[model samples]
Each structure stands twice: as C-alpha cells, then as structure tokens.
Target: MPPPQPRTHKAKPPSPEPRPSSSILLISPENKILLLHRVKTSSSFASAHVFPGGNLSSQDGPIPAPSSPERHVDSPVYRLGAIRECFEESGILLARHRDGGGMLEVPDAERERARRAIHSGEEKFSEWVKKMGGVVDADALLPFTRWITPTSVPRRFTTQMYVYFWPLSGAGQDAKIPIGGDAMIPTPTSDGGLEHTAAVFQSCATWLEQARRNEIIMFPPQFYLMWLLGKFFEEGKGGAMELRVQREKVKEFLKGSGANGVPWADKVMSPVPLGMFEGRAVLNLDHPGPELKGSGRRGESGHVVQVRFSKEGPRDVEVRDAVEMKRLMGEAKGKL
Candidate 1:
C-alpha cells in the first residue's frame, strides 16, 4: 500500500450548468429605474436589491411575431418570460392590444387582486393575461444584455435582460405610431416576501452614489450596468438613443449566434470579488470597497480586485492572500 499523502488544502468542486432566466428593466418616463430589495430570507439574492424578474414558467408560449424578428427566434420566450415576471414582481403591466391600440388600464382593485394571486402562485400568468384580454407585450420590450453567475457558485443562472421604455407620447395609438401604445404607469409594490421585501426607484447617478457608500449590495452585473448607464447619461445619450443602441446590440448578438446553427449565449461574466469556499454561491458583499483597511487587489486566497464605484478612489499596492477567510467563516459558524 502507498503511504498516506499529507492533506494541506482542498480544491473547490465544479459548479453545475447555468439555467436560463429572464428579467425586465422597467424604464420610466422620468428616466428613474425601479429596483426591488430581496427579502433577507430569500435563498438566492438574500437582502440584495435587484431588478424585477424570475425564472421562466411553462406557461410562457411561443414568440409573437411582427414585433419579434426571425433571427431572434430563441429570444421571444425569454421576452415573454421577462414581461410575465416583471408584472408578477412589479405591479406594472406591460401588455397592450395586438393591433397596437393601448395598454390595459387595470383598475386599482383589479391590480391588487392580480398581484396577490400572482404572488401566491394561485393564478397562472397565462390565465391572468387572458382575463385582461391581452398577450404578453413582446413588441414593446427590447432585448438588452445577458448576465451569467460566476463559476464559483454551486448553482448558477444565465439571465436575459430586456428593457421596455415608457412611451413619450399619448397612451393610445392614432394608427400611425410604431409597435404598441404607451405603457400604463403604476407604482411598483413588492408583495412576494419570499423573493423581495421592498422596492424603490432611483436615477442611475443616485444609484451609483449609494453603491459607493455600500448602502446597496449589488452583484457585478448590477454594478456594471449602473456604471454603463452613468456613462451613457454623462455622454448625453437620451433614453430613446440608449434603448435604440441596446436593441441594435441585441439583434447583432442574436444574428451572430445563428452562424453555425448552435445557440450561443452573449453573457458578460465578471470575476468573483470575495473568496469563495467549496463552490459556494456568494450571498452578499457587505461594504465592499478599497476604502476599508487591507481591501485591495489581492487577499489571502487570490486576486481580490474591487469594482470601483463613484466617490471613493482606488489604492495601488502589492497583492496579498486571504488566509483569514476560512478562519472568519469558522468564527461565524460556517456562514460566509
């Protein structure tokens, strides 16, 4: 028999394949975007603020055409899922007439009932849309980008981001307007205490400011999108211009994915900032920045670069390892 080898360290296990999910970026007429604060008890995003979205259900049907192009064949279901999840998570409904007439003006009572039923999973999304006599507002939404969770996570998601801008003109169409009518505006409310506990709307600049103070626990995708939005706003790119560019980019990605008839995902992947253990998913980044002492590009574990937010500056220093991670987790009763 061979001699026993000394056990020094254990390598992390590989994560499972990422599952597809969809989310919607609900842009208001005032350019203020909505964000939902996940419930602290939530299994996935726990206490982090995120956009209104969720996993796709079997009820999401085929891609509605004329609004969706043929090249985006694989994306319509995602779009449908996005719209459906947006309505369920946020009170705002994005559906409109198939003939591009106007959005359904759901009354306060009806809205409350629909929201409750949806949150409790007592009513199906397809049935609710049917009750309102409308299909998913596939035409109004523009596919924007994709975000994939880091490989360090045991479970992962490849989220599809879709953006829908509130109409600048009247609510109903006069027969000459483009795809659909103006979306009906509603105050967002969070009823799913299981997923989200609260909701708020803020400008991109304000959001970036909060990120600097570490008031919001944002992942790389959220952090990166906020950075991009701030830059775009600074460059004087109006809401319409930004959405147009995003729509064009989505088309490019879709068409490019069809080259070899194999579906390819256009995902913006970012490295994990904190040290992970045994392929565990990151729960939160509480007060993450270089402002803290010893917070830099390296730690006891590996490279620990901080994603810069506005306000505080960066510091250049030698790389260090995160030897205390295991110790800290141990002190905290195995909680990371």
Candidate 2:
C-alpha cells in the first residue's frame, strides 16, 4: 500500500445566485413611452405605474428562428422574455418574420387572441412565436440603464432596462398621432387582466407630477428612470433618432467607467455605498429620494439624485445636499 493516499481538499463552488431580469421601455415612433399600472392589491410595487416587464421565463429559451441583432450580448433569453411580456401586457409585438418580411402584421382581432392566450397561460409565448415563423427584434431594443432593488426591500430584483422604439409603418404620407406627454391619464384594460390591470403612455414629466400628487406610487429605480426620461423629453431630445443617439452615448459613458463597465453587471448587483457618488459619475444604485421622504419608501438611506435638465438636455445628475437639490428641481421645473 503506497503510504495510504494523502487527503486533498477541493474548494466548493458558490451556489447559483438568483438570475437577473430585464424590462422594456417601449418608445413610440412619435416619442411617447408606455407604462403599465400594477394592480392595487399586489405586494411588490402595488398600484405603481411601471414599465412593461416581468421575471424571465424558461419558455423564452432558444428556438429555431433568427432574431434581429441575434442575441443581447451573449444570450437571446432576456430579449425574448421582454418581447413576450410586452406582447402579453400591451398587445404589441416587437418581432418580425424570419424571412425578413418586416414587423408582424396581424389584424386587431388576431392580436387580441394572442394576447388573451398568452395572458391566460393557455399558450406559451415561444410556441406562438415559432408558429408565426417570426423572430424577436432585439436590434430595436437599445440598452439603457441597469438597476438593483435596495437592501431595505425584502424581495430584491436585478433589472436591466432597454429602450425599444416603435417604428412608424411608413405606409402613409401623413400618419403621425402623438400619444402623450406631461399628464396623468388612465388606461384601464381588461385584456391582460392577470398581472397588470391597466397600461398608460404618460409624458415623463407628467408621470412625476402624478407621483408627487399621491395619485400613483413610484419606487426608487422607476423614479430615477422617469427623471432621466423627463429631462430627455422636456429638453426636446424626444425625437426618435435623437433619443437613440443619446441612449448610445449613455451606454458608452457607462462602459468607459471601469467600476461600471459594459454589462455593468458587477456594480449594478452590489450595494452602492453612499460615498461612491462623490465623483458624480454614473453610479447605478438606489437611494431614497429626499423629496419623497414622507411619501416614498426610504430605501437604503436618505439620499436622492436630482438632475439638471438644461436646454441642451440632461446636463448633470446630483445626489448631495437637501436644499441645493430642491433648489435645482425648482429651477428645472420653471424652465420646463
């Protein structure tokens, strides 16, 4: 016996953490964005007006079709989930025929059928996509911001928000109907009467105003995004092409930062220290808003990021000083 084999220990790999989720900000051809109103009785973000999205599903896995932009970075999963959720909640499909036949051109009647089927769980989204011989148009989804739910929140979700522009049909010479901007409008729908009760396409500024008035609720990440979108539109960067360019700029800016590089996965998942915002760079973390102190959940700490929406467009994002932040908001509001 060869000296009875010496014992060796191997390190155990870390258990798989909960997977991340993705959301879509559907921007219409005329510059409006879509939002869904969560039912009042729900637990997480009850009665909050949020973007159209939900947790990823295994049904969103790979199929035998070609998708525009192929995959989102290294996986086709998130993009497919986003498309399915959007279709389920809003009755809008962001896909095209695999043969390059352009966006799915289904009649309003068929659209309702698909929406009802998926919403009821009677039909899996992937099966429907395959049956139609269409592909998820991931190219239309421009990467926007990354956000993580705060530690104070019991159930945390790591979410990536994408901007998808609803292209004009381009069939008619004069077909431009502006959906909305800066107002509190209700979209109570009975179609996807499951997770979501209604959908709205409010102007960014108006959405903030509604939250302030206690008409609807908003969590930290949602409010932050609306703040940026409010600036983008209020300063007239609302055009489709203009907004697209700005989205790319923001992506590059975040990528340039080592701590917040492309995918931004590392920084976005961890808790953002209070001291990290001293440099005024892109810190994609959640901090409770001072303005909403008495109203909104306090989040991890008593902190907020106030941005300056200049005539040139979102000039700066500031998170320090209570008085100064209020003053800046006043100035921005006046200008808007």
Candidate 3:
C-alpha cells in the first residue's frame, strides 16, 4: 500500500467590499410618491432613476440641544440631516409639530443655526436634537430595502432604504432653497428640488403599470419599489389609507431584518438590452442583458457620439464615447 498523494487547488480571490449610501422613500398625503432622474454628468449616475438620497455625511451623527424644547423647531439633529437631504434632493421635508403645526413657520435664524452647525461640523446630530428639544424618532423613517453595488464596478455603495410619509399639507409646496448648487428659486409644490432635474408624483400602481408595459425607464431600486407599490394598489384602495399601510409594511420589514442583514445588496445588471456597432456600442443602464441593440452617431465635430437604445423603451442613456460604451457593454457581457 502506498500513501495517497496530497491534493492542491487554486485559492479563490477575496470578494470586494461594499460602499455605504442612503435613500428615502417619501409618500405624500395624496398617496403620491417622489422620484428623481439623475443628472447626465460624469460625477452623477447619468440619467439613472433614483430616490432622494446621497452618501451619508459625517454631520449625520448627532447635534447640540437648544435652550429649551419649546424653543426648538424641526426634528432632531440626525433626523434633520435626513430632512435636509430630502429637501435638497426632492424638495420634501419629513418634519411636523406634535401640535399639528407646519415646519415652514420655523424661524429662519434657528434653522440657519442648525444648518450651519451641521455643515461646519461644529455640532453632532444628537446634540442638535437635544437643543431642539426634539427626539430623533427613527420610527418616522420606515426601513425599506438594502442594496450594494457590484465589485466589478469602480463605484459602489452600501445603502439603507427608509420610507417617510408626507401629509397632504406637505405635498403641494416646494422648499425655497436651491437643490444642488448655490442657486435659489421658488420651490415647486411637487418634488421640484434642485438636484431633481425632473420630478413627478404618481401612484405606485400607475408607475408600476407603466414600467411593466415598458413605458417608463427605472433603475432596480425604483422598479423594485414600484413593484411593491403595485401589491398595495391591488387592495383596491387609494390615498392616505394606502400610504399608511405601505409605511407600516416597510416598518415591519425593517424590524424583521434584525442585525443579520447586509447593509446593501449589489447593484443588479440593467434588465434591458445592449448593442455594438461601428466601433461604438449602446448600453441600457436601467436593464440587463446584451440581446438589445442600438446605434451610435457622431455629432458636430465628431468629438462626441450619441448612443441610443430602445426606440420606445422608457430608458434612453447617452454615452460620451466609444471607450465608455465598450467598457459598459463589457460589464453587461460579464454579467451574462
């Protein structure tokens, strides 16, 4: 008898780590929801559909206390960050007084004080909450879904999803501050924040129906939320009742996850299609797969080319160059 030969195999590479991000699922009093179409820029997702959110800042932690509860306005420090992000991204604020008063009436000096403190890192969100004589009611935000970006991509995010209900009173008016940059304008009553180049309020059923029929182009997160909304629509009710139920469902879902769930899931490939032509290709950022094909044409001095996909599909993304198009298409192929 002879000793058996030892066996050896290749070691697998370590999986890539995920990044962190945050988003809000805001529902208005009329049962309408807010959505944003990302700007078409290298620094942005480029026409991708998304909820109102961004990477969480260090200022999102805690804040100082005001002299007294009665003197405080708005929400707590951390929550105020969420409120500010909502206002900046979609022009919606989740603040309300226990006495049923409006947040708009909050004094500019106090609001400005809190804003400056947070932005300057002079205050913690918790301290700010205490100063405002308010509580950081995490309950106000219902946890929804968690998503992570794929390791193959240069950019990634580990995101937490939160759902908030905006009453009928908060649905119609827009905040006066600018959305992204320093420019200011009258806030649009709907979701017309500066960051949101295009915003709309529609029922989950309408959004889902359009998406299912290929009338709307949406990223996975938006599509998934819409699908969830469709489930509520089937119950045959509309307005505040439906919104409340959805909010509760989201709350329950978050509570049930406990501590074992991942902070976010990897970004799923777009569900649409892709194409390659004339040294250039078109990729649909909303959907996955390579079966879909489209054309790209050089414009003006030919320094830039416009890549278009799906003649009637809801998603229409324009890639700047052949290199980018090829890289994106390669990613799509790898997913397949």
Every model: Cα RMSD to truth: 12.0, 12.5, 14.8
Per-residue accuracy of model 1 over 79-113 as CA lDDT, tens digit each: 87887777777777787755656675567678778
Give the runs in model 2 whose Cα sits over 4 Å from its true position. Answer: 1-19, 62-74, 168-192, 235-336
Q: Write the per-residue lDDT of candidate 2 for residues 1-336, one digit (tens) a residue.
A: 568888888986543332346788776544466778877666656766788877677677852222332222324677777788888777667777788765655555666788888766788887787687777787777665545554544565556577776654321111124333321112223345576787767667777777655566665466665665565554455554665665556445434433213332222322343322224323324432222224322222223554332232222443344445445556755776
What's the lDDT for residue 77 in model 1?
71
Mark the regions of model 3 whose C-alpha exceeds 4 Å error after superposition: 1-17, 62-81, 98-137, 168-194, 209-216, 234-336
Error of 1 at 127 (Å): 3.2
* Clashes found in each candidate (C-alpha, N, C closer than 3 A): 7, 1, 28
Sorted on TM-score, best first, the list reads 1, 2, 3
Q: Which ten residues in a row have the lowest lDDT in candidate 2?
A: 179-188
Reference-based lDDT, residue 13, model 2: 50
Q: Could you tell which candidate, 2 or 3, scores higher by lDDT? A: 2
Better of 1 and 2 by lDDT: 1
TM-score of each predicted structure versus truth: 0.63, 0.63, 0.52
lDDT of 3 by residue, 207-308 (tens): 655655545566555665555455544434544455467656644544542122322121122222346544433433332112111312111111122333
